[model samples]
Target: MTDPAAHLLIVDDDERIRGLLQKFLIRNGFIVSAARDAAHARRLLEGLEFDLIVLDVMMPGEDGISLTKALREKLTTPIMLLTARGEASDRITGLEAGADDYLPKPFEPRELLLRINAILRRVPSVSETQSAPKMLHLGPIRYDLERGEMWHGQTPIRLTATESALMRIFSACPNEPVSRTQLVEDLGRDKGVGSSTSQERAVDVQITRLRRKIEADPKQPRYLQTVRGAGYMLAPD
Candidate 1:
């Protein structure tokens, strides 16, 4: 079963599909939000942080492919595209546009449930291994490795789901440079997302956001250092 608090956004033009999915997912222990089209999905995204987005590829105003492409520029949230078209090229196009997975329409709800759980499982979580440090310090901010929580002195700081995942990935191997390709793969993005260059670009956007929380000055990140030819390294003190 997935986390009961995990929120999902469902975008589809079909009212029946939207309602049915919302009801089904909620019954299975998810908090579901339904949007009728791409425009509605955009509005919800602007004001909300969803664990995942279930998007339909055939929306009227802005198709799922287009919306996925635009959202990828800023968000690292996992996206699963749903469409009636089952062609290989369509699936490739959706993945290239930054969708994490594509589920062709006419699929069983149980199958969808399993896919969603699989994708969520791939999201990096806290490292509780005996070898891992219990805490990580980044100047003024402190991270509890076991709890997956961050703090600045006595006050707690909020991190988005993706941000928390990045910390889990980095903290596991501090002072070591992790290539963007590896980070993308670890984040559950398939090779179908595109070339290494494009994949790295997506990871870059996410790193920028993470630096804002960990560094005193994001423009000159001290804790999150960029290696010359390598990738990013977390040099926590």
Candidate 2:
């Protein structure tokens, strides 16, 4: 059974598919919203937030992969792509494009439910222990793990949703070098959503934005330093 509180966005050009998916997922206990295409999805996205998105690869105008790439620019919401193509190369393309996961068309509804649950399971749960004053000092910035808050001296630093998610992921395994692939998967973007170059670029952009808020010198980051080819590691003082 799906979580009734889990909100899902279904995007497909085919009305039949969209309606069927919405009804089926709703019956399984999810709150679902359907969009006819990428354009419609964008409109809905501007006004509402979803726990996950079910996107169709083949659409009239903007394809699922393209929209996935665009969304990865700002949002870290989990996205699963529905595609008719079953080729391995196509699957790779979808993952590289920034999709968290992909499902081929003509799939069993049960399988879809299972995939959704699996992804949701991977999302870390908030703990009461996180409310303690366990803090990490990063130069002039300080992060309070329990409160999920960051501060610079006496002032609180604001973080975007994506930035906060990244911080939580990093704090869960401090001093460890987290690979880009791991970060992408944890962020809930389709693992098959982007090229290596695209994933690297997106990670870079997020890192730069995060540094501006947490680092005294964003250009020469001391706390969030890169680890050669291994990936990024957060070295808190």
Candidate 3:
């Protein structure tokens, strides 16, 4: 069962569908908010943070794909797109836009609920155990596996939620090559969040961001090195 207090934002141009989803999700133990369109969603986003966002692909203006792209530029909040049935191209486009997942229209409420739970489960909970030192020494930088915190000497380095999650995944299996598909899945994005091209690009962006903090030379990363045709590996000293 999902946490009742988990906040969710539902954005759709269709009033009936929006209302129904809001009511259903609320009944299933979520704190739900509804927005009529992308513009309204943007307004709500400015004032509040959400655990997840459910967005519809078709809208009067600023469709879900465009909004997803905009949000990905700054936010790491998980997003799920609703697309019409059999729209493979649409799904690919949505993923390219940085959506974490995509659901087809006419989906069962139960399936939606399940998907939501699956994504939420990926977010690590902050607890006492998280503070322990499973430290990875990377030259001038240090990453605490337990706390998911990175530090440069006495000064702490800040990481986005998505970056932290990626670190956890990599640290859990050190020196192992994790495929892009596996990383996307572990990141709690739907299989359709993006096409291979988009997902690859997203991974590259994240890797670059992470390397800047942990690597003495982001241009020539030694700790976070790419494997030939395999994926990426973290070689913490």
Task: Point out the worst 10-residue segment of candidate 2 by lDDT.
Answer: 124-133
Model 1 TM-score is 0.63
Q: What TM-scores do the predictions have?
A: 0.63, 0.62, 0.72
Encode model 2's per-residue lDDT on 1-237: one tens digit a residue: 435689999999999989999999998899999999999999999999998999999998889999988997777687888989956566667666666667887888887888787666545345833543378888778887766678889998765445666787787777888988777766654443346656555566667778877877889888888889888888898
Clashes of 2: 20
In model 1, residue pairs whose N, Cα or C atoms come closer than 3 Å (at least 3 residues apart or on different chains), thus clashing, are none
Question: Please, what are the lDDT tens digits per residue for candidate 1 over residues 1-237?
Answer: 767788999999999999999999999999999999988998999999998999999989999999988987788688899999967667667766767677877999997887788667755555443479988999989998878788999988765455666788898899999988788877654433345665566577668868877889999999999998898999999
lDDT (tens digit, per residue) of candidate 3 on 31-51: 999999999999999999999
The best candidate by TM-score is: 3
Better of 1 and 2 by lDDT: 1
In order, candidate lDDTs are 0.81, 0.78, 0.79
Q: How close is candidate 2 to the true structure, as a TM-score?
A: 0.62
Q: Cα RMSD to native, each candidate?
A: 6.1, 5.7, 4.4
Off by over 4 Å in 1: 1-13, 16-115, 122-129
| Clash totals for all candidate models | 0, 20, 3
